[model samples]
Target: MAGKSSAGRTRAARRARWWQLTQRWRMVGVFEINTGHEFYSLTSMMKEGMQACIQATSNTESQNSLTDEHFKTKGTQLLEGFEMHTFAAPVFATLRHSLDISEQEFMNSLCPRANYLQFISNSKSKADFFLTYDKRFFLKTQSKREVRFLLSNLRRYMDHLEKYPHSLLVRFLGVYKIVIPNQLKKYFIVMQSVFYPDERINNRYDIKGCEVGRWTDPETGGKQVVKVLKDNNFKEQSIVLGPEKSWFERQVKADTAFLQDLNVLDYSLLLAQQPLHQDELKGKHSFADLVIRTTKSLDIEDYPTHLEPSSVPLLRSRSEEVPDGAVCVPGQHQAAAEGDGEEILAQEINSPAKDTRCPVELQGFHKHHQRLLPNLKNAVHVIDGLEWRYFVGIVDIFTVYSIKKKLENLWKNLRYPGRVFSTVRPTKYSQRFCRWIHEHTQ
Candidate 1:
């Protein structure tokens, strides 16, 4: 009887914690629908607006739709006593399509019926982060200044993605502002999670390539503490990328250059590794094949709008081009990662430069893992003679080298003359970042 009572208390405590985290996002519908009594109509309006945005963008015929005015344009809707505003809906809708995300897939993945957003409070910053139940998308709260900066650079950001589809930069799918009746306004930017497909990451690192204050706290004991280990916490492991090394190097160079051109600094490389045992690698199913098999088991009929396994003709055609045992390194043979990046600083917000190129037509690859492979390929890598699947992406590029950052850099340099800080000038920071990756990664 005592053991049963203790277990009941423990379960109650866990339920309380989960409720505390998720309750704030609840929004009771005017006429509540039975959803197992778990969800409270969260994100209904946001999903509706997103679907409409995608539809409107697809039907538009304007050649200069990606103008500064278009990006600055805001659409507002009032639903269930909450005012929701979508920033640059058409622009971001185009970006979603470019990233190979369909309206149905995005809506289902983000706004599922039974499960809502899960709060993630592990970040160092004060900004709140939420992950959809499926773990496909991440919604991060942004400050007003950060939102302004993103809006100002939305045009160039889209162009960069178009020119270099294999760039490692974190993809921002949508930006929105939510206003509660008689309450404060909240801003959010929806992004692609680096560890998509809900993979189990054995180890991950938030690498800034800086020496000072880059180590994780030894006493910070928690379930989430070890998830995002820092630069100093990262040991020098033998990271063998094989054919992926050259492609990764080139993409990093181009991505950092794009950020540096915009005077952005203090971004980190998010690297995650999923270890695979010999049995899993050599079994009837390979590492990726097992993931696909698991995905298939999860009622593929439910997500009929997404890509069918037989529909990925591009991936199939490319797979045939490679030998049986050869690595399928993405963008390895392509010239897109060469010296294609130009100085985008010359472009102004008023006269937004137009990208005459059409959005990439990925009719069947609407899934997260499908789109992720082209950018930061989570391919199998032999690290220290053990098989591992690697996930890599660049994040937090909104921090520009403004006056505040300049002063902070000045004070830090004076305080520690020889120490390397992550808040250096954007150009210098980019150079150091590239040099560090070259030295650390194979």
Candidate 2:
């Protein structure tokens, strides 16, 4: 009973007082797959601790009263207090229950280490953005208006997903709220990161196809980190989708229908290019492989370390509490393993670099030092004279054509001399965006 339920917030919600928290945009965390390093929030650490304390108190207080069926039906309670609401999604809940993992394991994946959410110096969105430690997830600040909009259309969105399971829209996994005693409430929407773990993106662009605020000149103010260049910048690179161009266009059309139907706009075709130097992709003995070598040296965290001290006690023997018909299990999940465990571990860690090389076969490389791109045999595709796989996702879909955006556009129009701003009407924006993508998608 610590945190107010989403139901409670929905009951008391109104527009006027809650729209004040859209000031600074601070981003949190990132996860690197190759290195297995991830950014996690300390507040997440705090939440886990607080959740453990609460669960312990609840268990002790209820004792024999809370039966297995009762606990199973009610679900495990996490942190709660104040007027805000936060809880894991059904997918997470089912996964935890099915796997028989401690609640802390799920929490760790959501918010791992004590990594700080850094401010994205180049961001144009009003909401703060944070990347997870492994960069597989993004945590962003949300405004009251947007949250309400999403809540209103939540069912429609769910139905759409149920209809088209593989729709390219950014996977919206979870939504949450944080309310402090006296401040405006903090809202967060957690999303699945579009890119994959093993891929190294060399050239990336956030293509809105809008002329206004889309361009990030090399001469721009802040130092360039991982640059989210504009449409113009993207065009300059002339990186075409190549043989997969047709497939991409089909995907765009499918995704466009979904967004346009929902009146969603200001979204971008986020494209990341991982130019796998033919040599690097098949680089068996090259120095570029050192990054992977060093990554392997580091001690990777298999589970959230923060939960170890106190949570160890809370995780009572699983077998002792099993119901009459239940099965006893061991290892990571409540499942039995087959085959050599060592082989499975090695396959996961030492997955062959190309078709040829394995970690076991890798020596200090005093013998062979050749560009191995030509020698390795595997699936191949050439894009603009270079072979690469483009990881594409439609992001920033939460921006609705609200009254605030309308006013902002009006002000921008008056503020600027002639042409209406790039952040124009949502319909026009989406049209222009999709058109530009179609035109340049060679």
Question: Which one is best on TM-score?
Answer: 1
* Cα lDDT tens digits for candidate 2, 1-442: 5366775676566432344332111121122322232323324533454345334432232222223342222123344444435433443233223223344543565545445343344666777666555445566778877767765665566555444333456666555666555744677776666654423556567887766666776443544345567777776454454323433443455565567667677788777676666665466234445444323322124223654432321132212332332211111211111222311221222222122221212111101110111121111111221355556678877776778888887898788867535556655665555556556655
Best candidate, lDDT: 1
- lDDT assessment of candidate 2: 0.46
**lDDT (Cα, tens digit) per residue for candidate 1, span 100-171:** 577667777766654445443335798866666666787788999999999888889888876565578888
Candidate 2: where are CA atoms >4 Å away? 1-42, 45-84, 91-106, 114-119, 196-199, 219-224, 277-386, 403-421
Collision pairs in model 1: none
What is each predicted model's overall lDDT from 0 to 1? 0.61, 0.46
TM-score of 2: 0.54
**TM-scores, each model vs. reference:** 0.66, 0.54
Per-model C-alpha RMSD: 11.5, 21.1
The per-residue C-alpha lDDT of model 1 at residue 59 equals 58
Predicted structure 1: lDDT: 0.61
